[model samples]
Every structure is written in C-alpha cells, then in structure tokens.
Target: MATLYQLHSSMDKLRRSTEQMAQTWRAGDSIILLGATAAFIDWLNAYLEDNDIDRIASIYALADDVAQLGDHTNAKLNLNTKLTAVLSDTEWVTLTQDPQFDKVVTIAL
Candidate 1:
C-alpha cells in the first residue's frame, strides 16, 4: 500500500503539471487533466476506505490537522473534507467498533 506521504507528493506533482497545462488554455488537454485528477482522487478515497484500522486512524489524524487549520480553509481545497467525502454515513458508523483509541477516532470523526 502506498503511504499517504507518497500519495500527497505525487498528487502535488500532478496538480502542478495540470496547472501549467491549464495556463496554456488548451481546452481538450485541460479537460483530460481534470478528469485524471478526479479519477486519482477517487482511487485515493477507495484506498482510505479499505485501509486497516491503524491506517484509518492515521488518515483521521491527518484530517483533524486540516480541520484545525481554521475557517479560512476552502471547502474545495480542504484535505479533510476531500478524504471524508468518500465515506458513506454507514461506513462512518462502523468505525466506532474498534475499542482501542476510541477517543482519537471520535475526535477525528
């Protein structure tokens, strides 16, 4: 499994390249890039959902950090929202089953 750090670094690179391409105003190319980025985000969301308990905790902690960044954060660009947006309400409810680190998970949720 790819670590979150690796995913972030790769996504950052993809965004920079996509931004550069968008600057050129080539409509077709820009659309392709947009689709690719969306697909990548979907893959990431699935990965997070399928990860083990420890990894899920790590992801939640990461999300909490973003939430802590305050109200100035953009809804479109917020990592926590992006990450959690993939989860269904039912999936979220299941997370409470793990007895360990209940406090951390609750705070993250």
Candidate 2:
C-alpha cells in the first residue's frame, strides 16, 4: 500500500473513534489527548451542550503542541487545558497506570 493511502486510512480510523467517543461521552470520561488534537475540543463541547450532556472533562494537552499553534492570544488558547510541558516517559507511565485511567478505549497517539 502507498504511504499516503496508509496515512489517510489511519486518520479516518482515528476520526471515527474520536467521534464515537464524543457521541457516547459520559460524566467521568476524562480525555488524554496526545499530539495536536485541539481542534476537536470545540466540536466536543458543542456536542455536549447541544445534547444536554454534562461531563467533568479533564483535558490534558502537551504544552509544546499549543505553543506550536502560535501564542496568538498569549496562551489564552490553553485556558481549559492542563498543560504538561516537561513530563518524562516514566511520569506518564505512572500517571496512566492508575486504575481509574483504565477506560482507554482508543489511543490516537
């Protein structure tokens, strides 16, 4: 298979998985977004509001990704995100090892 085709397929699968998660969102479902997944936030928020679904959303984002998006609003873009800039591999492994964080149905990173 062509590299471009594989990339597209992977992206399509990711989008579908994310959309399904958003659709069936529950109160305690916290999102650990890796890479640059900020664009989905607005849509997810709107979907929750429009459906009258309430969730205590804890969004974890990489500080570097937000910076790469440009500091247009002086970091206001990360107002709702828990930014982690210097977390090591071991730190992440430890954090995700919590039993409560085991509901990981889809990982896009």
lDDT of 2 by residue, 1-79 (tens): 0000000113334555445555556666555445455434455455445555465445554445445556664255544
Q: For model 2, how big is the CA root-mean-square deviation?
A: 8.6
For model 1 the local lDDT of residue 84 reads 36
For each of the candidates, the C-alpha root-mean-square deviation to the true structure, in angstroms, is 15.2, 8.6
Off by over 4 Å in 2: 1-18, 22-24, 51-53, 73-91, 107-109
Instruction: Count clashes in each candidate, considering only residues at least 3 apart in sequence or on different chains.
Output: 0, 0
Task: For residues 1-109, write the lDDT of model 1, one tens digit per residue.
Answer: 1112212224545544333323332211101111123324544444333431122323322323344444554354454454434324353344433343222111000
Q: Output the worst ten-in-a-row residue range by lDDT, candidate 2.
A: 1-10
For model 1, which pairs clash? none
User: In candidate 1, residue 93 scores what lDDT?
Assistant: 42
C-alpha lDDT of residue 9 in model 2? 13
